[model samples]
Target: MASPTQDGVLEALRPIVDPDFGKSIVDLGFVKNLEIDGGRVRFDIELTTPACPVKEEFQRAARDRVSALPGVDEVQVTMTAQTRGRETPQGGEDLLPGVRNVIAVASGKGGVGKSTVAVNLALALRGTGATVGLMDADVYGPSLPLLTGVSGRPETRDKRILPHEGLGLKLMSMGFFLTDDSPVIWRGPMVHGLVRQFMSDVDWGELDYLIVDLPPGTGDAALTLTQQAPLSGAVIVTTANDLSLIDARKGLAMFEKVSVPVLGIVENMSYFVPPDLPDRKYYIFGQGGGARVAAEIGVDFLGEIPIDPRVVEGGDRGRPITLHAPDSPPAAALREIAGAVARKLVVLAERTPAIADANISWVTN
Candidate 1:
């Protein structure tokens, strides 16, 4: 009996079509690292986005197809996802070299837990086996160093800033450069320059997703990022309350004015669930305000994150709940929101024509 080969395996998988793009995984360049050891076979399927709805379906089909190949005794299939835009890069030293998708997590006002959402969301995406980076663009209030549980200034290597790594993520933040109590009071131009440097100077090699934590409000940071980064889309973070909702609308409008697609809205601190009463629910922030705002704005309502004390404790203690207490309510909620965000990326990538046109300006620079 003859053993199976890589070519034969590729041929078998060439027929598996991605539901979002209606193209075979092989033809779409999703298959990676095909290996054959006697009767055993293993390979990875890199989806266009981590939130692809047909992820499980694609995995099942690939395994079944490869297992049916000649002399195949065992088959293992791994799924990986990356965000892609329509614009193709020109040959040269690439800008943001190795970064596939950039997502800005923004808000219209402060104290809405935007940093917390950004940190947990990045961890959630990393859980899906895609390389992820969390860039803290909130110069005045960089919290990733504390949230990711890592503290120290980034190292310089060959003139490129090396991001601090911890909690299964690569992180860059102004927090790392300052003491916990120090303040960053810079002019508008300085702030813009720093944001630009973060994008062009950091050595984020080959990340599947770079989740940017933008400062609260539709101010200089948000405007600078919208005009500069090759963003796949923006995820607006809002709380369940009238004031927060009103500000969130401004954030949404800012993205719209800049032609940045609003992927969805995440309702952080949506409600409060007392630890003592597991079954009881409390309408602390006023119910359904986030969802209502999302509907009113005509963007996808990613999901709601109930207010939990652990979430606050985790952030203060430099331990994100998504990693420390994966089973907790807020942690689980973050994962769900992450999944929804991922799925929304797929929709944006497939359905939006602007992403393609926008890519041309950044990818070729």
Candidate 2:
């Protein structure tokens, strides 16, 4: 039997292409640290995001391809990721210099569980071993401190405000600055200043993702964030109802107007699954409104998060469902949504010539 040469191995894996990139893994230079000894083969397949949904498929394909080699007796395919970032025009001087992607989680209006979705989404991303930060951009109603159980004024180091750490995530929120009864009665300029301070004056060091929970609506705070923040993408959270979907469309329009890509729409509380009846679904807020709106607007329908009581309880206690009850249906749905968001960002990054050039490692023929 002949030994499998490096060129032969590359050829074997060339047929396995990334669905998002529409190119061969070998051509994209995803196969790394390849080593061959006798009949055994070993290599790592590095992806753009740790939360890639197709990682398992890639791993299976690579293992099967390499194991089929004539001289290969064993195959070791390690899946890894180095999160890619959108290219900032300012480069290293950008406010979020260490943060790769800034994702805004917004809603059409309040009372749609947007903050809950944001908290759990950040937690889900962090669960995937990605360094994540959560910024409650809702100046009027900051929820990060309450949702993550992180409170008190954040300490300042030198000239930068240190983001409070909780639930394995770096967090910043106006909630930390106010007492429980304090109301933010600031004007538009003050709101803008606070949002800018959160971006530039905070020390959010080296994060794969920074999930910004934008205040519900297309008002001053939301508009300010969309304009000022170097947002990679936005996810609009809405309930599966007509009124909520209406606001979702407005929120979607806001991001579009700012030239920020809307990654997709996440339907929170899409259905109610009673604890007693685990197998049954109750469509308390009508049905399929989220999907219909996404289709009408030409955006992706990320997924639906079923209404779980634990979702509220977890947030109230500063323990998001994705963290405390990770195996529950709602938690699973949030994880799926997070993965979809990560994949969408990758697609968007690939579409941008500057970001694509900076992130992709192309193999020469």
Taking every candidate in turn, the Cα RMSD to the unseen true structure, in Å, is 4.2, 4.7
Writing each residue's lDDT as its tens digit, candidate 1 over 34-109 gives 8889999988998777657678998999999988988999999998865665343454234576776788999877
Local error of candidate 1 at residue 69 (angstroms): 12
Q: What's the lDDT for residue 220 in model 2?
A: 82
Query: What are the TM-scores, per candidate, against the unseen true structure?
Result: 0.81, 0.93
Q: Candidate 2 residues 79-193, lDDT tens each?
A: 9999987775532346677888999998888888889988888989998889999999888788887788899999999999999999999999998889668686878889878
C-alpha local distance difference test of each model: 0.81, 0.85
Q: Which residue runs does candidate 2 get wrong by more than 4 Å? A: 90-93, 242-246, 355-365
RMSD of 1: 4.2
* Pairs that collide, model 2: none
Strongest candidate by TM-score: 2
